[model samples]
Target: MRTLTGVDSACSVLAGGCDSPVRSGDSIGVPMFVQTRAEGAYAFDESGKRFVDYVMAYGPLLFGHTHPALVRGLDAVAADGLVWGSTHRHEVRLAERIRSHLPSMERIRFTTTGSEAVMSAVRSARAFTGRDLVLKFAGNYHGHFDVALLDAGASARTDGGSGSGIPESVKRDVAVARYNDLDSVDALLRGREARLAAILVEPVCGNMGWVAPVPGFLEGLRERCDHVGAVLVFDEVITWLRLGLHGAQGRIGVMPDLTTLGKVMGGGFPIAAFGGRAAIMAQLAPDGGVFTGGTHAGNPFCVAMAHRVLDVLEAHPEYYAQMEALARRLADGLRAILRKRGLPYAVVQDASVVDFKFRSGPPNRNYDDACNADRTAYAAYYNAMLERGILLPPSVNEVMFLSTAHTTEDVDETLTAAEASLEL
Candidate 1:
């Protein structure tokens, strides 16, 4: 009924999406469909095709688009002042709110992107511990920092693996450990436990498409980190506010020494933060020595946006419950379709983050389970859904997100689309 010509053009412009050089980090994806634009739950491309959004800014648009609550918060803050080179009310308030969510945090610092927040956290760990090695999981993406560009150890590299040209020095300082496999991490630490500055993780792997920490895996890491005196950092940039007001830390109950936050914290705006024990955090800036500063680190627009976004999450903790119920409905509905078609499919998710593993059998428990899924089937399903008016994240490596804006009716319509697209 509608078309995605605009999505193509925009991606062309965004990717080359236009005429400019596509920078490595900033280019837009060739949308599965595009045209008019979007409001809440749905977007219309130039061709007027209506598609339900399954990619809510990669888990940031929790309350959906142009939310009145966010708008009001932004408007009120914006009217007061744009940016203060000095302290401001909203900044202190936001910090208090963030600390309240994760009582473990004694100090907090804001940045402009998830990458920056994570980078700062890692740097702080190195400073506080005086150790150089930073450990990260395969398939868990922390940011574009030279050290974090690693691929998961088991998954195929062709599907967005580690990049090249990084200094051997940088790569040497970083180590890649297997996801959900405690033995693998145990082995890495056996010989040189004291050298590790920090063990950075996603807690739930979204970059490799919705994998979660194995039971006892997190607590074990906590024990290991404490034994060796390394900081355990959770890169909750995507999972932070989406999982709960306190984010993955609150939901999973495995606290990290430091937490990096983004996505939902910004409410579709550019903002990120890292916080942890006060003494360790004091190692940053005028309080200590980390040598980092950003002119636009915490601009007014971002503060306004984040404060509004977070406040709403704080007010309606019930939203997370609603999102979880909706996610279960979608996951179960798709499983029924796979069963009906006699096709192999696995669904994975925690809270609002969900995905279909186009594999040969049952749902996977870790990255390996996800890698075993059927890529061809997923691509075909993706094309069919595009044709039908539902928008999903393009790459299998990314997890699908749900927002407060989607309704049961929308969920059912999506299920119908999946059934038809499955090819009986």
Candidate 2:
């Protein structure tokens, strides 16, 4: 019999046994468990261990694993074929549905991934403004693309250099500012406003563990961008449908000139989009000069799943509230457990996401504060939870997600496991 030893050896055919760094276990202090199958709010590992899943496919499974509607919609759409490499009605309908909720998106463009959407948005902004410099907040991950990778989140290292092979010229065009702080943004723009093309932000700072913008912070970015003639781009990749139908911009009443959305929009498939004012989006190729195209940009299967997810959410907006309530319950339970155990920690809840930090003090307000999380303690706690059959976000900085499929009983069971885990 072949002894595989661990996940690393099992995934020998793949680089580092994972495509994404966070999926690996080198930093988490345990071998990454192999999940063989998943259902609504639960996943079973290769060993047949049942675990309550809070990872939720890293924030895309809003309706939970393998939703019946998604499965049915995709099944029906698959009969017509997956990709046509041409325009389709499903794409048009999805775009119209998204525009109905986000009026700021006067025109929209679909892409295969959030990174492509962001890259296109930046290209459009630069083309429209005839400027080069783009401002991004520290720890707000846009994607693995070169310009957006600097000062990215979800990395094991904190030197702010996400990965190698990025050119120095690309780094020069990008400037990093501290999240939730308008002063840092002002300082970066004071001497370079004329050359600034866009100010990209994750309105809710999901990458930094649900650190939302301080009051007037997003508004400040809007005003400054207007004053400087620079486009304001909100990277709502994680907060898109998860925050609300209108996204963070509509929920907070601070609209951006451009917005990028993904995750829940695909309903577990891979699809993302970016759109804004008509004049700006018109700069894309065939219409203007900036070029971006993918064979599977608006895949039929993905569009069908997105439409199904959106239809359910639009008809029953209360589902958002219910998910938030469950997340709040989980957060409250964590707080109670930590307090009773005299563990100094913070559990931050925003909508359907809950972020717990193994550190003493108030909730994290920015990337710097989020960095203070005790990874050692979190690793131990993560192992304990895993032992008890609860799968959380493997990374310390990642947020735990709640789905509509997660029931009250699941929350109670999680708390029970959490209590015992804390004692471990």
Candidate 3:
């Protein structure tokens, strides 16, 4: 019998040779390397080639692959059980930890994924306000759910319609606004024929690269939501712990009516949460008209992992500082390299998250501006870096992450790779 190669086996079992289409390597025009193991800041492919990982499992492995503390915590918890399918102590404790940092989460409910959390949050907002319309910013992804899948308009003036299978009716109920633009949000809210239920945003845009909110942008959203009685939902799934210990809301000092959290909270496991004012959250069923539940929601194992992640973060405030320092070093080095070569590029960063855009200036404060970046240039850079044993997100629109497990040495090595890769 012949043994199957990694790509061959993956192609046979998984569509596109990867669970997620982004990992397919089609964007880079190269065959994807199948990773067999990952530890600390590096991952080893099937061929035993080591690559420094900057994706960090798309933002969940905050402590990096198979962190010792996380492994020990999971091992201890696994000895106890997997799932009891009932209320557990860990769930309650985890909720308390999250609420301590995000006071806006007066009440909380866990879900199996960030998508579910966002879906439930929208439902609760609609139920609580008895309003049908929800305004979501363009390029600020909430999940693959239909309501959140509506595409942006050809121009900012018109409301975006649904993508493929989503009904036109669903598109009518959802409005698209430009990120970091107060006027765009105000226009939609003011023109509303009926009351708007919620305005969901990514506090700090991550879906369309690592763009941040302009000054007074979030504050303006808060004011608009208050005036129109619309729920302001911050989708902090990617920015939760990546921005800071307390999340983007805490870092920016702008609070929202409801918040959705995931990614870092699970510490490489599957867990997410949605919560807000007790009155608003009370709308979720078992107690209210809005309904949401999952069998694995808040299962002990995921909850235990989440609890351990929070504990580790709380114990080590310096972890944030260290990672931030490393990120700054990397961004600075890359900027220096680009400047020396007289290349037109923009490096946007916030704390441990950074992204590169091939443009002469900073990205304009909207998705349209981000779209103008040179993808061809990025593809060339990505392939070059990958060949040099450095792994970056396959797409230019995605942000690269830094972890506590990364060292100054790792940052230096990445810079060296970037200097060579950018020559493309």
Candidate 4:
């Protein structure tokens, strides 16, 4: 086995020392702690140090890392083949399972990543509506693709995208609005209704520190889309199964014309899906003008894992309640500890996700408020927690997650570590 320093040095050969921008350890100025293996809710470093994991692979490990049942299923699937290069029963069954939970997805299409799902959904919206404009919120991240990258959240440096190679025309066709502010949406959509193709949003904004929509916000969007005849797209890439069985739409009682799902459903595999009413989804290829295809769209291995994840959920619906309860315990414990220390931090939680801002006072209501969190202070806190054997999302913009594998004991351990980390 490679030593931690050896692994760290080996990473230099990779761009930014990481494949994904968000996974770079240096992005947060922390020395990379190399994980050799993970099980349940704990990760072991190269030196065999154990840490209580709260990141949960950015919310895809709903049941936890290397879940025994899921791994066993994957092993069985691998015996047949990874990818068959043709339609298979696994994808068909997975789609049926997803549609059972999200009835709004009357028609479905698969993709290898959430970014592709968003891209296809946007194209389908445009083709179906014969319009050019797409409206997205300031801190909502659909994906890293060109149209979705504008004014995206989840970046530690800037609210605006890097703006490197994105076209000027693409930027012009997109409009950014403030989340939880219906007025902002109305202001941008006032005269552009005729040109609007879709209003894409994350029903629960996870990229900007897990900001939940205010009561009327999503309903207002639904109404606005209805008035404008533009498709309402819910980017549930992060919230999907993690939020609840029905997801954010079910949890909030508001549905969208189109929905994009990823993360939890893939069970850590590279798979995502987009679907909505059949009328709109009909715009895609083989049935309509819009075109979308990928060889790895429904990889057999990924589909098998997805089925296993759903099997667990369907068998034990109580897992959702347990995860949420643990999340509440963790969030409330942190709040109490922060208060005792006279720290101004505020903890926000919904379902199984939790976020703590470095600022004192009210919870974040929008991207700007989330940005107001002190990064320097957060970095210190993050490093301290890591030293105390509690693994957290390295970025202030990212949220912590809970899994069925996590328990009351893990929550207590994390809280104790958190309180001790503050003392450092």
Clashes (backbone N, CA, C under 3 Å), per candidate, total 16, 0, 0, 1
lDDT of 4 by residue, 340-365 (tens): 99898789888888889887778888
Tens digits of per-residue lDDT for model 1, 265-295: 9888888988898878989988889965677
Q: Please report the candidate that would top TM-score against the real structure.
A: 2
Per-residue lDDT tens digits for candidate 2, residues 152-174, read 77653434353576788888899
lDDT of each: 0.77, 0.87, 0.83, 0.86
Off by over 4 Å in 1: 1-36, 72-76, 152-163
Model 3 reaches what TM-score against the true structure? Answer: 0.94
Off by over 4 Å in 2: 1-9, 156-163
Runs in model 4 deviating more than 4 A are 1-4, 156-163
Give the CA lDDT, 0 to 100, for residue 332 in model 3.
89
Point out where model 3 deviates above 4 Å: 1-4, 27-30, 152-163
- Give, for candidate 4, the lowest lDDT window spanning 10 residues: 155-164
Please give the ranking of all candidate structures by lDDT, highest first, separated by commas: 2, 4, 3, 1
Q: Model 3: per-residue lDDT, tens digit, 1-424?
A: 1124888988998886887666776654655767888999998887777888998988898899999778875567888888888897778988998999899999999999998999999999999999999998887777777787665311111234332667777887988888988888878777793579998988988877777899999999898888878899999999898877789999899999899999999999999999999999989888898989999899999998888888898899898888888899998898899998899677766788777777678754678876776778877888788788888887656778989888898889899999898776
TM-score-better candidate, 1 vs 3: 3
Candidate 1, position 135, lDDT: 84
